[model samples]
Target: MAAYTQDAILLLGDSLAQGKFDRAGLADRLACVYVRKMDVINRGLGGYNTDWAIPVAEQVLAQQHEQHRVPRVQLLIIWTNFVHLVNMVRSPASAYYSPNTRVILITPPPVNTHQRTDRSFADTESYAEAVKEVGAQVSVPVADVWTEIWEAAGWDELACEQFLFDGLHLNAAGYEIVFNSIMKIIEERYPEIHYEKLQTVFPHWSEVNVNDPRPSLVKRRVPIV
Candidate 1:
């Protein structure tokens, strides 16, 4: 694999960004030769929107330079789950979209129509659009998750009772689907390439096993989706 001799990878975004859904340890499952379990940093703060994401990303990006690795940011995953928050920061120059980092915006998962009525669907679609617009301004790639869920199960089934035990977050299989979806995007775009950088090798996959007790939810899925 082509060596990305970088160590730090900051994943900054909202609840979905926190990656609370993927019990499969999705980030650990990435096929990046430059990145490994230890290298991927979960900077995802539950319930945060892009308004909050910018500062966190800035803080990390400002002092976060590398000595050995060439900054293996083969992928920087982002998702926006907050519209009210982004609205609060519309005119602020401190918004999340910045040119300093490589980025990919995952369309925030769709809202559960059954669980959310009262214009939540509008809010979610608006949020998704806002995310895409901001990412476009900075020339970042957009990961179309809106299509992913809609095409597969539609909002109702994707947000069905069995799919979400808590009526918000997905169960194990749901999480697996989410994780695989994101990874598949990365693999498709980055197209992992093998290279022998003298002493370099892929980092050890996470030691965690499937039987290990599941981790807690770091971020709540909006609208019980």
Candidate 2:
């Protein structure tokens, strides 16, 4: 087999998961913590819902035969609405069924009705609940970001303004809640792949031999456990 470098964590979702607008988005935060341990791949698309994400996932995820050449996806963080996407990876009948890949579902944050007239507060709440339901049915761990942000805002729909900048998209404070929620799930359900538990692919600077640094620079494989 060819030399394997680093394993990866793929983040898939809409704009919220994309984190292009906010520097403190979940993907960025995870990268910071998981640096050198695992590569974080963000595949979030703007304004895309469940329908659009399914096809894109098909294209992005490697097929069974191509798995050898590509970096293994150790963790897949899905923020989009999916029962199909989960099936694609978890179902034995599917081509993308990756037994080694761990999956986590994330709910969209609550909408701020006070600042936005397009989306209703009830509707957004229902959407979050639906994502949780899908996660339950599919047996995938859920981050439940909706509930976390709501509780952070003291359960007031109007008070969600503190987290959301434009009533729809999240600001720094909002993304902080998201990062925390995802980390909690990782620590509880997927501790093996947690940053603290894994070693870096490359040796730390101090581990390098001053007389022969080349030998110390060789990458090491970080086992899941």
Candidate 3:
């Protein structure tokens, strides 16, 4: 069998990261946009805060290192609830173990209290600020979803509901904001790794020669140094 390989974009967080709200969540939108260039992995754990995610994330990085898979991590996106912002921000730093692995800390979006009682908008904002502080301390990029979504909604509570499926989780419109923000960061700071700039695994079908197809199908092998 041919060894399969691709770049990776890892999503780690709670119910929001897991895409509990919609079929097409953050990871899904990114996958569609970066199709064939990178594989988007969703490691979202429902109801688990950042404290629980620390060890799990460490193990995941270790496993990836040991496995020596073709799909190396290019981007690691993390977003979780406010209850454990401090630990969550500190823990995901281990992702740097893999060289060239870019990290993006996403703050949870604003909550619509009318929909649920598990959390409050004020509480979530404080945590979002905490996440931004962590991102700055670690020198990692932050999506700041909380601020972006609220601004997009013109800071109106009722208007913001369109971005969320429930009081806490993001809906399609909300995820789009995140996806755009992330891509903006990548485009500005890490243009080299931008999906549009990367080459596809194979040439476009129109570019392939019909006769003597082996030359088109097989790549020239390079000698190991």
Candidate topping TM-score: 2
- Best to worst by TM-score, what's the order? 2, 3, 1
lDDT by residue (1-225, candidate 3, tens digit) is: 646456678888888888854576888888887776677889988888778887777655544335365556777787853323323334545332455567778888988888867778898899999888877776777888899998998998778888988767788888889889889988987777788877655656776889876678653221110
Q: Residue 57: error of model 3 in Å?
A: 0.9
The segments of candidate 3 whose C-alpha lies over 4 angstroms from its true place after superposition are 63-67, 81-96, 218-225
For residues 186-219, could you state the per-residue lDDT of candidate 1 as single tens digits?
Answer: 5565433211221123322353344652342122
Q: Please report how far candidate 1 places residue 181 from its true position, in Å.
A: 3.2
The whole-model C-alpha lDDT of candidate 2 against the native structure comes to: 0.88
Q: What is the lDDT of every predicted structure here? A: 0.49, 0.88, 0.73
Task: Score every model by TM-score.
Answer: 0.59, 0.95, 0.84
Candidate 2: where are CA atoms >4 Å away?
Answer: 1-4
Each prediction's RMSD over C-alphas, in Å, is 11.8, 2.0, 4.3
Deviation of model 3 at 37, angstroms: 1.1
lDDT of 1: 0.49
How much is the lDDT of residue 15 in candidate 2? 91
